[model samples]
Target: MTDLPDDLTRFLAGVAPFENHPDAIAPAARAIEIRYLREGQAARPDSGTTFPEDPWSLYIVRSGAVALCDSDGRVLERRGEGELFGHPIRFGQQAAPYTVQAVEDCLLWQLSAVAVRALAERVPELEAFLSSDPGARLRRVEALRTRRERLADLGLRSPVSIGPDAPVAEAAARMAEHQVSCLPVVVDDRIVGILTDRDLRGRVVAVRLDPDSPVEAVMTTEPVCVDQELKIEAALVEMIRRGIHHMPVLADGRLAGVVSAGDLMRTQSPHPLRLVRDLARASDADAVARIARSGPALLAGLVEAGTDVTQLGRMAGLITDATTRRLIELAEAELGPAPVRYAWLAFGSQARLEQGLISDQDNGLLLDDALDADGEAWFLELAERVCNGLDAAGYVFCPGGVMAKGRWRMTRHRWRETFSGWMAEPDPKSVMHCSIFFDLRAVHGDVELAESLRRDVLEQARSSEIFRRFLAAGSVTHRPPIGVFRQFVQETGGDASKGLNLKKRGVIPIVDLARVHALEGALPEVHSEERLRAAAKAEVITERDADDLVHALRFIADIRLRHQVERLRAGEKPDHLVAPDALSGLHRRYLRSAFGIVREAQQALAQRYVL
Candidate 1:
């Protein structure tokens, strides 16, 4: 190897993987062979006749462009300056059928694979560089979030066990000694029941039960529990739904630890595991309002921590659910209990749990059909207070009066009728209502009402072919803003003229596709990703297409999340409009890719629903 020229050495240090290794420039220049590849210079190797002597070589583009074509002559990938290309180096499984050819005159470093590998071993920095695949590296930056840190990551209280045959007094003593709220009652080294302090206070002392009685007599058999591998946010949702203070944590199908509200508070409070708990205890609108204001800051923290957009959406939805539920509780406390059971329902984004940083609250109420005139009057008053409280808490009421404060949205029986009418008619407004109301979920109260409505909606859509067509029409209403030239089609005229509304033109198309497919297949999910997965599971959509749609949805959603995070950091209100000019070359490229996927998805939907 000869000593490197200064210009050649400088070029090597300028690219990524290499950008971090300035010291590698001299050694790289000395050991690597620089080939000035003129336009279409690299041999095409048609029929494998033009293959280089040692085809196992790494190529780093210093300038100009290169395109790798498959054996069929399809341009499989395009690489530019600072990008690396070489199948033999990336995937070392014999010969690859792709031809590496320069698209223009280029200065490429044809590094010997053997030497690069040896250099990588000696230099730790180069190892990271060499290990990074360019395509995967971008996708990794796009990696919004992985699964929530599992519960095992949140160090738990040591497992304390007591026999089911032990006296209630001894169980209580054990809890006292450990300062724990609950204890798993094991029999034959397996948990059969659990006794909590609440059980002792309510079932034993309150009833004046014999303290010497077997713990099994008072213990809750088969108590609600969670696995140690579950995410904290998911655990919070389950615990909140069950109205339990503590849940037994399991490992290897046996009791491993007890995770109390106190533990979640310590670990996830600032992130909403504890925020939900506080929302539950919020005694008044003022208390709820205070916590709601913190939502934006909390969201900012999540985005900064590189939380995945999907996880961020779920957290936001949980916060909204907890906030709304708290407001309902305050309303109930003030207005007195309802004459009949009623469920508070969320619609649209809230229902789908795709709520972003800013959203107008869209919700309704599902009252028990048994409500009389007085009951109706009581319910209306409650709705007024709750909706108003929510508005004050930053969930401004829907400008379309879509909030729970409406009479039309107040009854479960009428809701079914409303769906039937919409399906039967399928007018513009009715179709619009169908879009909003179809993804309904119970945010609070009698969930069975929601279940019944879900069943009815599926049945109604299944029986009505015309209704499914209308749903398809609604889905294709908005096209992704990517144009025929593989360029962004910006909003020509409107308040959003600065850029495309990433929400409407990008995210919503996939959401609408998911909604249509889910309804068509009678999938029982409200979330877009869940609906997509469920639809795929039923074979309604091929697995590859389904996966493409899912990836597109996440990537588009991540772009919006990033935009919102940027606005929040700049102390400005977050919105979905994003100017392509503001994005980097890589970002714009991915944006086009994401929007392209949505276009393909819409075409798929259109082909399926031929009206």
Candidate 2:
């Protein structure tokens, strides 16, 4: 190979996909051709008359800058020094959908498609970085920076087992012999129950049971089990959320091993668990608020670690659940126990287990039908205490007054009647209420009351075709903000005038689409992804369409999360607004594609439901 210019070689050595591979820098430099353009020059004109038409080339802005514009000349992205452009053309696009123009006098380095292909063949990392798929680029970054260990990587040994018919003495003897604290009770190679030291001490030894009693007599049945493929961080989250010390691990539907809290604690950070524990022991609402204040910081750390978006949401939900439960406990202690059985119901994202850092309170109180006027007054006081406590803990009061304090705190019969009336009327206001209240889950108190209400809601919604159509019509109105020629339609007023409402314009459209299908299929799922999957299984939507919607939802959610984390780290309150210009060229393209997917799903929904 011929010697390259010294300056060019040095610059190439500093660029990514080449900086780490010093040996490839020289060859890459050899293939480069330098070009210059005056201010206001179009690098690739719409007529394709400025550059060679045979083999497209990639351009690196060595100095000055350039703007990528849509067909009508609206700026899509601005590229500066060290940033590469014209990747689409080199990656097999017959012609670029957007034109690249020099925003100022520029110095550029250009490499032909053939040479770029040769370099990619030699460097696998370069291949992934240069791929057209945004997911490939994301995966490369995650693998290099934030790849987490899976349960299998912990080198867990096969669990010691005891047959369900085995005597209590034999089980204890086996545990002592193996130095294990828990035993999976197996029958026909399946785990039927679990026996722990706690069970022996609390159930058998404490009660003075016979030593010859069968293991199944005291073992806890239907124990929680985690898959061997689960990430260490996720396993720790589950353990902390459930307050369990030992969890059985399954591989391909059979018992593989057992992971204890100690095992996970050694591998993962103790911050989240410690926070939950502190919340549990919190003496007052102020103490709970103080401990819960660290939630955003904890979430920022998780985002920095490249945790999956779904898991990030799950972590946030856990914090909110713990805080809410603690506040309820404190309130009950102060205001005295409820005069009637009631369930503290969570609506919207919290109930769906997809809460973000910028969540508000959306809850109601479901009281037993046996309540009288005196009991109602008592429950009202309880509701006020919990709502006020939540507001003080940073979940601000709902502007729409959807909290449990007022009309929402109703008896079971009233709730049922309200649901029935909403379905029967199918008016605009009723449809709006159905959207929020239908996605309810019991966060605390009598869960049976919540479950009963859910069943009635589902049955009524299933039979009411007109109500479903009204819901579909209402949902289709929140379309993704994609304009003609595939550009982002940004918000145009107030504080978010320069950005797009990612939560409303991007995430909620998919959420609504999945929800419509879920209701049509009578699915019991609350989470959007779960609803999509369940709808697919019920044949309410094609599997391919379900998968596409899921991918779109995750991609948009990931971008939104990263954006919020950035704002949070900068000491600003996080919101759903995101400026298109703030995103990298690659992310902009993928986000546009995600919005397009949502639009297509909405159109299909409109046709199917005749909205």
lDDT of each prediction vs. the true structure? 0.76, 0.82
Query: In lDDT terms, which candidate is top?
Result: 2
* Candidate 2 lDDT by residue in tens digits, 1-611: 36688888887776666766778887788888888988999986557553333455678889999887766778766777766776652211123566778989999988888888788876667655654544444455445644568888999988899999999999999999999999999999788899999999999999999999999999999989989999877887687668777889999988999998768666645456777888999999899988888888877887787677777777787788889899989888887878889999999888887877778889999999999999988888888888888888888998888899968999889999999999988898988888888789898999998999898889889999999999999999887887754558998877779788889998888888888899998889998999999999999999878877887788788888888999998999889989987876546656765776788778888888777
Worst 10 residues of 1 by lDDT: 87-96
For each candidate, what TM-score against the reference? 0.80, 0.82
Backbone clashes in model 2, listed as residue pairs: none
Model 1 misplacement above 4 A = 1-148, 188-190, 240-243, 306-308, 371-374, 579-593
- Return the clash pairs for model 1, or none: 144-308, 145-308
Query: Which parts of model 2 have CA positions greater than 4 angstroms off?
Result: 1-111, 122-148, 165-170, 173-179, 252-254, 334-337
Clashes of each: 2, 0
C-alpha lDDT of candidate 1 relative to the true structure: 0.76
What is the per-residue lDDT of model 1 for residues 1-611, given as tens digits with 9 covering 90 to 100? 58677777777666545555566666766777777877877643344532233534567787898876665666655677766666332322123556777789988777787867666765554432333233333344344235457779988868998998899999999889998889998877677888998899999999999999999999999888788998776676566556677888889888889888777667643666667777888878999999987887787777676666776787788788889988888888878877898888888988888888888878888888887899988888888888998889999989888877775455777888888898888888888888888888998888988899889899888788888888888888799886543457788776868887899998888888888888878888989989888988998887666776777778778888889989988999899999987775446655665676677677767777764
Per-prediction CA RMSD (Å): 5.3, 4.8
